[model samples]
Target: MQKLQFPAWLKAAYGRCPDAIPRGLQSETIAVEDACTRVTSEPVRACNAVPPWSVAARNGYAFRTEDTNPVPGSRPSKLNSDSDLLAPGRRIDDPRIEPLEPGTAIGMNAYGPLPVNADAVVPDDIATALDAIQYKRVLVRRLLPRGANVIQKASEYAAGDVLLQKGQRITPERQAVLIAAGVRELKVSKRPRIGVVVSSYERCAPLGSRSCWQTPDACGPYIRTLIEQWGFEVAQIEYISPPSRAGSTPQALHEAEISYRRRMIELAQRYDLIIGSGMLSTESHRRVGLNGLSWFAASSSNDEINISQGPGSRFNLAVSRDRSPPRTEKFEVKDATGRVRESHSIHHFDRATFVNLPGFLSSVTVLMHVLVRRIIDLYEFVETPGPCWEIGELARDVECDRKTNLMQWAKIVWGPRGEPLIDPLPDQEPHRVSAFLDADVIAAIPVCRGGLAAGSRIHFLRLDPMRQPAAPNCAIPQPIEIITEAHHSTEFESMQPQMNIAQSWSCLNAWLQSMPDAIPGGFRAAASDDDIHVLEAAISAKLPADFTASLKTHNGQVDQDGVCFEGESLLNIKGILSEWTCWRDVIANDEFEGITSDPDGGVKDDWYNLKWIPITRNGMGDSLCLDLDPAPGGTFGQVIRVWHDDERRERVAASFEAWLCRMVMDITGLEEQKEQKEQE
Candidate 1:
């Protein structure tokens, strides 16, 4: 039951293949504008320098810097203006235009080539216009430096400069630069052709079929679409039908196997890569009367290899066609000196690679994202993996056998401390499609591990772009009253006194009554003194007096929708104790060891602190806590925000009382605005 490591298998399979161009991958000449996302077959060079000639950067009078000189407390220098103005599209050699003289200036428009021998320009704003009997005169108030307001020719890029390297994909920004550098055409690699074969023992209907007993062929279309998105072309998708259900006769099985083999051979010759889906497992191959490894071994003299095993690694089966006689073709290419010379390229026909993928939608998705994408990148000569990788804590334990790699899909959720928590989807069975639909990342569990425990840190590849964390909606309202430095001092003597607990609670209660929907199902009853005492003993930290008073007035929220502060709900005594104990366990186990924390505005520099008691939670691991053990310059009992996925620990208020007052103000202000709109 030993399984091969995927990386080692990939290296051994295609490692020796020359880094030279992929065999049979041809190049085509296309307009530069249409080459975005296409891989380049050869390097691209600029045909001409940007800004072919020295041009004026501003609309002003262009003249040699030596033409004018002004002394302190003396009158400005005057120069004669040329009869003809210089503008874009006007040649300097035109009969009407004259070469710039030593004491003369020419009117030049922005982006217009400078008149011959003109080295500087004084902007119109600074040049005073004077009427003269003949043409005109411009008075310069000061001496200007040479080359001022002029864009020198060839400054951006010189002709024959390499714009893009071979094997690089043309991104939109790169394309724009290439086009600007006078590159009109590009030689790009042709999209690799892919053929998909879905071989299933059960009769599956095509999409949109209404057959009551037959399931649809989901893997074929899904894989095809994914391949297309990777810049490859799916030439054909064929389905191998199962034998009659009435009986499994030897003759019927033989005919089915012959048809499947013929289709595979044809695809291998016509396509660069042939993907075989379904009947990937040994048991499934036996049931279908076709063994992939045996068939490939018998069909070709080349070595047949099992690249990897297990559900996720099954697609690593790579089979190649028989080697063919090498054929050479002559083509023309430019050398380093820009000389076009004839070149010869050798290629072997009918040498396509084959990958046997499992039939389940979940496995298909993982393989397509991780394995198939990498294969395409190889063919295209892409040097880097596309998606970003990140670290996250497991939300729950994931159990798997020690003999196989477990590829699990997980949804990323923010923990109460702004850390990323990986929530593995429940439906990982091969046939289930819901897991694929809800997954944000794919976590690859290496072989020889029985399981991963909750809170265990693991690295995962992002399936899609990470979503931005929810913004704190109930932030301190505008016309913000600036809290003085004394308010945040560690000593309470210097702190600004806040409104009494009763007054703050009254304001919050009135606002809640006005907006009944604000707290869905209303608030829970106040916590008993015994319950509060239990919470304090569990966390080994005493609650702030203001927080205790507020809880006694009305404990935590009754429902998730009752978000009271900064997109979080007030936690009851028991809820606070549970959250505190859980975080404490994670810290005690050193699960967050070596993890970095981003502290802002006097917050302590630590991932999690035992003295920070959870007061409110948003259920995704983000919480607002009362910091009893603040940093050196921070005030005690200050409220701070903790995010699960984010490293930031932001101080929200000087104290719990201050936070409560701000929330009341925000709610009351919102209500007043709503009333004003109604009045209007």
Candidate 2:
């Protein structure tokens, strides 16, 4: 039988990829107004305070705290807008308020400055306004509260405060904030230029004439859109293809590689990061098959996790290529460190990493998105932290393109004591909520599933090693199986889910073992302390014999920090509470009688004393009542809804799409359609 092994030539090329480009200058300056999407080079602080002067907080008046208050049965006092008679103690700079009789009148304008210790009375209280000048001062009202109707200096942002942080991409809101903080312009990191290398030439030309097909320029524009979505300001994108004359000649391929490399080198100097499309492949010509585009086939190593791990020994081991191909292992390559001095020839390794991913264009789109985003983060020397509670199943579902199954997913982001930090959609909200989950048919399944699932293994080893796993996701254990509704006599029939589970678990268990430094016996460590407890509970669940033993042998310690298992959760509400800072009071307090739905109805209905439980954690609070048109339902002329955590909201959206795709797949029965059409 022919061995299922990667090509030797592909392996050597990948083993020598470059670690990073040689240092080069690619400087350019863009106008601040034209710099949207550019990464910020440095932190931005406020140039000056907002509202440089003490401005009116409300249109009613501006005044000092100390003012005149009307005393019972005393002589009345009359005051005018510009006169100092309204001053406290009848003294302009006095600290205490002067006592006056109940019948008193005063006047003031909203922005007019108050004399020291002199307060101004608003028109609504002293006199009703017919126009700007005609304030008819009536009578002295109730006692005025201290510190009312005044805005202190520096109430808004103060000068020198950091308005935007370094490394943050500029957004409209950020721009507005900077402007509010008195920034007229900003210095930001230049958006990186991209150089694309596509191999569109034909392998053989007909009678010295070139093939009509052009490399699909579709990728070029699509890439632009994707980068913009990632929130980067793209400076430029340039497309360069292999020479059209290089077909059917040995020199043709070599020349193409060299020419493209030269162009990339030049572009690299002008770009912060150079991103190329396609051309990391073994094939001389483009192939339509998905397998033909796989990263593994094109390059020769599994470097996804390595790029994300950081600059450490673990990362080095992940990308190492000195070892020989592994024997009897699913993922194995030659090690990268040891050099073979065969006679006069010595081989030296290159330092860059190569990633091979086999998928359809749509799936590739998502994968590239994840890859580029993570890469940019890595290039900046930061390991982007994973979400507190990732929707692993949903992420898998989306990756597998099983869109319809995602409708059932839901996760809550909460504070300690079950208090929700995000608002949930109110029941009366006019939108359907749903979730989604899916199974990974490829890669590792846990061994607890059993059988081919139990003993199956895959590995990734440096070099063309004989004992490493074949690929990242290959050799997954089968899905878990449980005996449900089976007859007392039929053992296999009784446990469908259990049987599947055993198969998946065994496969995954064997596969993970091939990987180095995994929890001994195919177990992994938990992500957090809380995960340690949940890991035990999950392992204790009824699983396949082989899978259970693997767990038992590993002592329930798995690489929880690496990836979470099905039942384990990593979020800690306590951490969020400890990190809590300031919050704005976005509450409303108003006595509401129902207002007429129709403008023509002059009569106002008594405001409904709607008894709504405050969305509270501490004390009583309220939401202001605003006039709104009610739908046909008599239920709550008012509406209330809660907030959703970010991750949960993203999952719910992804799940809904997955669910739709699953429904379509079910109805089409695509394989059956393909067969039927073929028979015709």
Estimate TM-scores for all models.
0.53, 0.39
Q: Which tens-of-lDDT digit does each residue in 349-428 have in candidate 2?
A: 22222232222222223334334444443333221211011111211111111211111112333433332222112221
Give the alpha carbon lDDT tens digit for every residue of 151-227 in model 1. 88777888898888787677777888898888999898776677887777543547544456667778888888877
- Output the lDDT of residue 326, model 1: 51
In model 1, where do residues sit more than 4 Å from their true spots? Answer: 1-25, 51-63, 70-118, 121-142, 203-205, 208-213, 242-246, 280-282, 286-293, 296-311, 316-325, 328-347, 381-430, 438-680
Instruction: Tell me the lDDT of candidate 1.
Output: 0.67
Question: lDDT of model 2 at residue 291?
Answer: 17
- Candidate that scores best on TM-score: 1
